[model samples]
Target: MATSRALAQAPPAPARRGQHPGIALTVIAATQLMVVLDITIVNIALPHIQQALNFNTTDLSWVINAYTLTFGGLLLLGGRTGDILGRRRVFIAGVLVFALASLLAGVAQSSAWLLAARSLQGLGGAIASPTALALIATNFREGPERNRAFGVFSAVAGAGGAIGLLLGGMLTSWLSWRWVFFVNVPIGIAIALLAPLYINESERHPGRFDLVGAFTATVGMVSLVFGFIRAAEHGWTDSVTLLSFSLAVVLLAAFVLNERRAPQPITPLHLLRDRNRSGAYGLMLCVAAAMFSIFFFVTLFVQDILGFSPLRAGFAFLPISVAIIAAAQFAARNQVRYGPKPFLVTGSLLVLGGVVWAAQTGITTTYVGGVLGPTLLFGLGMGSIFVPVMLTAVSHVAPHETGAATGMLNTTQQVGGSLGLSILVTVYGTASRNEARQQLGAFLHQATPQQLVEFRATGRLPAPYSSQVLVHGISSAFQMGLVFAALAVLIAVFVIKVRPAPAPVSPSGEGA
Candidate 1:
């Protein structure tokens, strides 16, 4: 912090190629790490948040969904916004917005308030993130400096989620869950303030803002997720649920139509025309759908079921970072030699094995017995898939459209996570509801007066009964994740064609 603080204190001047490269890299990389890590950092604090804000189990996914929905949905548009407006200006504005949103989230007194704040933070992130990457292109000339910059930025981005889990735990355990949000304030402000001094703006490109594309895509996804969640609570035929689904279809259809016509389309529909690229995106979507949900539910299981403290729960996932990095390096090194299909097929199989193993988890499962194998397998699988998918996505892309190709891959990840989590949470919510009903009579018979009182007030069964219900729900959700992992395996084995692609995979961190 002190070293970064000193960098900020230097007098304002645009960066010159050989001038304080470390300072510019630090500012840009820090901003990127902050944006990327926010996807998971809050997971450690979820239990605390639910208790404080009275968030019902079904409603709780919105804390994550809200951020991802806007960020993923608006991502392409954000990158284009940076192109039209100067990257540096958009980057600073985005950072400041993120800081403000963090402040609001920290002070949030209700579920709605926190959700709104989180969504705003997503908007800020979508705006800042693409520009942060673009700024690296402008600040460092293309060569070893640029490659090194990307590598450093990418490393921070890659490690951010694991870092978030640890940091979130420490903050929640030592200070409070609110500090998870509060901690972002100073860092974002520093980034916002220092960016102008060390980073230079890129030349503005002429482009039209794709307002229609962004609106339809974002709203459509929201409606679809809301429909699933509402179905969990109310049932499939519920009027609101049906209406949401109906609107989602209409809006999403219209979105695709708009993209085909919009002069500066947010998503160039043509990116999917290539078979290999499309397969890569599909693989990514399935992989993310499975992986993100595991992160969410497992965080809950470690804390609520296994009785791990927030800090301890955070550390429980540490090995995943190691596993993923090792496997990703292996894949990156060999992809040119062997091509992507073999790694893709093998990786997806690893994921399938992991998720199937995880689906068997129950009330009696221990961390060693239940968590370790799946976590490690999933980590390695993801690491292997990431580099290949990224390269395949951008393969055959025109030079001018390369950024859009990679951006789509990132968008697929966020959107896939949101959609997958929504579906899994829906399954969990319904399964838990039914399990609770089935166990109610038994629980009531043995319950103490105090336990009965607590149950009446909180609608939560104490200890053994609660654990039984949660295990039922979480296991059901993991089973659903298994289906996604299977789909990824199928996609990798049959759909991803053997193609020699020369595209350099952006050192982009695996999608959150």
Candidate 2:
């Protein structure tokens, strides 16, 4: 009882007085941008990395999967760690670790070395990302200040993937692919140094870490993600794939049971009881699934079908980043007055439209006609969805559980992206093989004897037929992405019901 009393009497965090809060926010937002961009920054550099490290096509994917699996799997544990330890301390440590991993990755000589470094980078990201969000809750009061801060954070989250593509292109073209990793070193060091002088630490809670919950949840997610990735490469009926799925189910079930009883649960079961919050999670999951698949498939389409250079392909996404940032700012300003539901419903519909439009792309489609319009629509819709969804996810939550809530949000996004991409890849592979056979058969029937002889000698389809087959496969995958986006709209409209509260007034007698 005395311990409980002491805990209840813990002092609130120190407030910023003379210091400009903007400096602190910039540091936090920069860190978030770094963490989010790392997920995609390595994508454009993959072909180069594979060549340099002598990675086979089959094993090259591990460079990405290694990072995603560890990051998504360990996020809950990382969040809870911040709740027990101070967020600022953990945040700094994470940045230091991330910088070191980036250095190692830049200098890596072999496939094994790079994969190890990427996995370590994922660990650092898991530690830093949630703590970064939790820090906003700690540093800013629950008013316009917090809203504005979240606005910047949300914009960064939405735009980071596109920005990464551009940055990756520049680095890979002008310098080397290694610069993508090397670039992070300076940014991480700057953030770490500035953070101590600007950001205040949150109050720590005394609690036992739930080792059982952490282990089960992390392993479960890893298993699930591995199963999806393997199913894309091998048939779904493969024994190893079946085994991975089974282990995921068993371990995830164990995690749920453990969470229900743990003294200090990594994911508090009570948080899921809120209808709006649960709905937000579902909505974000579906939206992210489509969004990530768009980036993956569209990148391939432009590079392979349109025959774009990496630099040109990267510049193609610049409009998306700009659109998202602009829309996010607008949503952030107007959401308090109009509420989140309108934005959620409208934004999701736009996403549905965008993906559906993209599904019609063909071998002869022009960049301006086929890609630019759909991407702009997607960017606008995604930006609107992010701000409201983020606000609703943590609404009415207790201060201490802020980290856990935000961590869950980020996990849903990463896991959903992995699952969605795997599903799309499966669809693409099946469709491409089928289309190739059909095209080949049709060509054989129409080809001259000399053409047939050349085809037989080369053992490959002609350029036009090959491009058509590839485009057909890509279009089919976009159709699937369309379904995902439509589902997100339906979920947002029916499930989410949170209305925004009126803007808070500041101490200066003005609306914040």
Work out the TM-score per prediction.
0.85, 0.94
Residue 243, model 1: Cα distance from true site in angstroms: 0.9
Give the alpha carbon lDDT tens digit for every residue of 72-166 in model 1: 88777777666666677778988999989999999999999999999999999888886776676678754345545655654555556777888
Error of 1 at 23 (Å): 5.9
Give the poorly placed runs of model 2, Cα more than 4 Å off: 1-18, 447-458, 503-512
Give lDDT: candidate 2, residue 218: 84
Cα displacement (Å) at residue 132, model 2: 0.6
> Model 2 TM-score?
0.94
- Pairs clashing within candidate 2: none
Looking at candidate 2, what is the lDDT of residue 366? Answer: 88
Computed on alpha carbons, the lDDT of every model, listed in order, comes to 0.81, 0.87
Question: What is the C-alpha lDDT profile of model 2 across 460-503, one tens digit per residue?
Answer: 88888899899999998899898789889988889888777976
Clashes of 2: 0
